[model samples]
Target chain A: MELLLFNIFNGFIIGIFYALMALGLSMILGLNGIINFSHGGFLALGAYMAYSLAPAIGFWGALIVSPFLAGFVGLIVERVLIRPLYGRDPLFSLLLTFGLAMIMQDLIRTFWGATGLPFEVPNALTHPLSQVYFFITGYRVFLVALALLATASLFALLKFTRVGIRIRAGNADLEMVSALGINIYRLRAVNFSLGIFMAGLAGVLAAGRLGLTPTMGASLIMPSFVAIIVGGVGSLVGSLLGGIIIGVAAGITTTYYPAASDVVIYLIMAVVLIVRPRGLMGQEGLLE
Target chain B: MKSAASRHVDAAKPADAMSSQKSTRRRVAASALVWALLLTAPYWLPLTGGYTDLGSRVLVFSLAALGLNLLLGFTGGLSFGHAAYFGLGAYGTGLMLKFVTHSTPLALLAGVALGGLGATLFGPVTVRRRGIYFAMITIAIGQMFYFVAVRWNSLTGGEDGLTGFERTNIHFGHAILNLHNSTIFYYFTLFFFAIGCAVVWSVLRSPLGHTFVAIRENQKRLRFLGVSVGFYLWIAFAISGFIAALAGALYALLNNFTSPEDLNWVLSGDFVIICVLGGMRTFWGPLVGSVIYVVVQDYLSSITVNWMSFIGAIFVLAVLFFPWGLLGFFQRRIQK
Candidate 1:
């Protein structure tokens, strides 16, 4: 019973991280048809930034600053690389993004060697939380709480705010929104940057939980993709649900029948594709 | 009546000229060049020292890229998980040699069969979707295979991979073709490569190939024309898988070992790069792309460990500047 509880706890903890990662990718895909393969690279950058800066500026400061730095880089990429390929063939965008992904990965490898870097969890969140039924790590619980809070705030802003309305409108029909005197190009850039920022933030959180590594991005990329696919593409709620499902499934697989853990997520994706081609929460014709 | 007949003749001229003049001769010459190179490479390449190995590697990758071109270029399907077929081929051959007799023919047959079966099963699910969804599904399946290959240690030898496999003797009825000699192995690979290229050429010239092109141009219109789009796509996927497996078997024979790296997504991406860089529309585009990719990768990797970054930069430039690929670029210049 205790073991199951611990697994569930660990699952939710990791699921929140997955949700954070998938949210960014979902936004990018929703706004632009391009699957930004370099989102993982941004996540890696955020993780590395936190790793390097945490020593000097402290962990809290690094967490606050890393995402913006990553976002700034994302802004440059959008303007210089991605903007030109907007109306072109989709394959070109895929190829360009893949190239960018490779570059980011190589750059990280060059700066930080192939080995994993250690990241100490902040002391304030590391305390143990003992309850009547179970005991949980404070840091992990804090991570889940923080993620939920952030997601709620973002959801509220998107649901209520004017800028959020514009972003949603831009996603639905770019030409129509632009015709209404909105700068859709600027909107896309902002949305892309914000997505990157979220990815960067997730990276920092992940580094605290999983440690930082150059090749870590590669592992994250596929799972996040699986999450997005299973959850439904371009839906925030779908991403949240899909992320949790994959995370929990992966966590469970890791505990029992460990050999199948790596593949379990992909197996889930394949099953999902076979059963629900549009994904669990994805709308029809979205992929089209 | 005379004017209309003359108009008809005039209309047929460009189509005839386009097909008969450039495509036919160019294709023949390219095949002949490939054959000549394959025949003479073992002898001629040794003069440069270590060029034989490089030549063989180029041939292997080119053959694999050719398979990819059939699906990506001709069929207009972006398969992000082709490495699954490639790895299936490699592992199939490797496992066969490990347990059964190290007979090249048997191993090749087994690899091709396994690869075909895997593709037949997985293709339906993936081919149901179009564009990015198809690509994503393929990627998911490919990653699944990779994970299985890594975790299933008892069967695949885990992370270290299924190594220690010896080169097999190629059996032809009563006679055995010895692959212990590098020159002999090159000839064997050359034979298969020629056969593979011929098969691809035949397929491309078939009615199915035209249908594939039509489907790529506009699937909805084709569907309206009473064509089963899904069936054609499934066939393309299966054939491509078969060819990739054939390439994998050949690759296993060339290297005498197999590893998880054979099925990596990066390798699949490499094939995509080869197809696009070579000129997807052209028959010999994948061949040219594979040669250039192998040469650049080999040359650059020897010079610096940061070759990936350089390759990345090259990809960016290629996608931006040479959108039609090198062959298209050359064709444009010639046209001018």
Candidate 2:
């Protein structure tokens, strides 16, 4: 029972990470129709930034600053590299981002050196919080609470904020949104930054948990993609649900058949594709 | 105006026919030149600081890219998971040699069947999705094979990779054809490459190939005509899988080793980029692209540790500047 609970909690944390990353990918994919292959790169960049800055500014300051810096980089990438390919085939953007992913990964290696680095968290959070639930460390609880807080704020931002509503509106009908005299180029740049910021946040959290490596984000990127797909491509809430579902599924699988853990998420995706081709919340005609 | 236009077209018919005849001759010459270059590569490659093995690698990758181009270029189906089949082919051949048989022909057959059958089975499921969703699903599906190869350590040898297999000599009647020699191996690879090329060429000429093209141009219109677009797509996907598997089998034979990396989505991206870099629409674009890509990669990796960045930059530049590819760009120039 303890092992099950432990795995479930672990899975829940991992699911939160997937949700955070998928939210960004889903946003860009929904708005631009371009799969940002470099989202993983941005993720690693954020973590690396936090790693580099943590010693100087301490963990809290680095956490607050690193994602924004990553977001700024994303903004620049959007304005320069991504903007020109907007009206072109989605294939071009895919290629462009794929290339960007490679370049970013290489750059991370070049700049930070090609070795895994440890990210140190505060000492207070490392201790177990309860004797009954030895797995419930203070850091784990803090991490979960932070993730929940971020997810809620993001939901609130989307629901109540002006830019968030415009983003949602643009996703529904770009032409209609454009006709209303909004600068979609700027909107996209902001949206890309917003999505990347989530990736950045995920990266920081991931680094604290998984340790920092050049290829750290690569493993998480796929699950996030799966999460978005299973949750329904255009639905943010669905991405959240999908992430948690796959994570919990993986957690449960790990206890009985450890080797199948990595593959079970993909199996779920295949089943979802077969049973619900449009996904749980995918819009009609979206597949076409 | 219509009658005048018709009269002008009728008057220009002879000239148009003459140019077409000239073009046909030029095409034949170009094809002959290409074949001659390939056949004589072993002789000239050493002079250019390249080896016969490099030539073989080009042929192997070209075959993979060509296969992928069938679905991607011809059928407009975006498959980002082709490396799954490619990797399966490699593993199949390796396992057959390691555990089952020593016969290369048998191994090749098994490899092709394994990989092709895998794709064939998954075709219907994947064909239901379109565009970027298609790409996402294919990639996800491809990862399943990758994880299996990684975790099934007892059989696949896990991350260290599968080894202890070598290509054996062939005997036809009384004479023995030695394959250990690099030049001999190049010829052997070329023989299979030629077979793959011929198969793709024949398929492109068939009515089904035309239908695939029509589907690419307008799926809705074809569906309106009551054609099952999904069925044709499955056929294209399966055939491409078969060819990619053949390439993967040859790759395993070349290295005498197989690893999980062969099945990774990164290789799939490389194959797709090779297709785009060469010119997806052109029949021989992948061949041209493969030559440039392989040579450039060879040179860059030799010179700098940062060759990945350079390769990435190449993708960016290719997409931004040369979206049509070398062959397509040249074709455009000729047309103009």
Best by lDDT: 2
Q: Write the per-residue lDDT of candidate 1 for residues B1-336, one digit (tens) a residue.
A: 112112212111234566657755765786688777668887877686547777877788888888888888767788888888988999999899888866778888898898878988899988888877778778888888888898899989988889878777766799978888777877777777788788888887789887876666678888999999999999989888888888888888788888888888888888888888988766778878988898899889999978888888777877788766787677656544
User: Candidate 1: lDDT of B55?
Assistant: 80
Give stretches of model 1 more than 4 Å off. Answer: A131-135, B1-23, B47-50, B171-175
TM-score of chain B of each: 0.91, 0.94
Off by over 4 Å in 2: B1-19
| Weakest ten-residue segment in model 2 chain B by summed lDDT | B4-13
Residue A108 lDDT in model 2? 98
Q: Per-prediction DockQ scores?
A: 0.44, 0.50
Clashes of each: 0, 0
Relative to the unseen true structure, what is the C-alpha lDDT of residue B72 in candidate 2, on a scale of 0 to 100? 86
Worst 10 residues of 1 chain B by lDDT: B4-13
lDDT of 2 by residue, B261-314 (tens): 999988898998999998887778889999999999999999999999999999
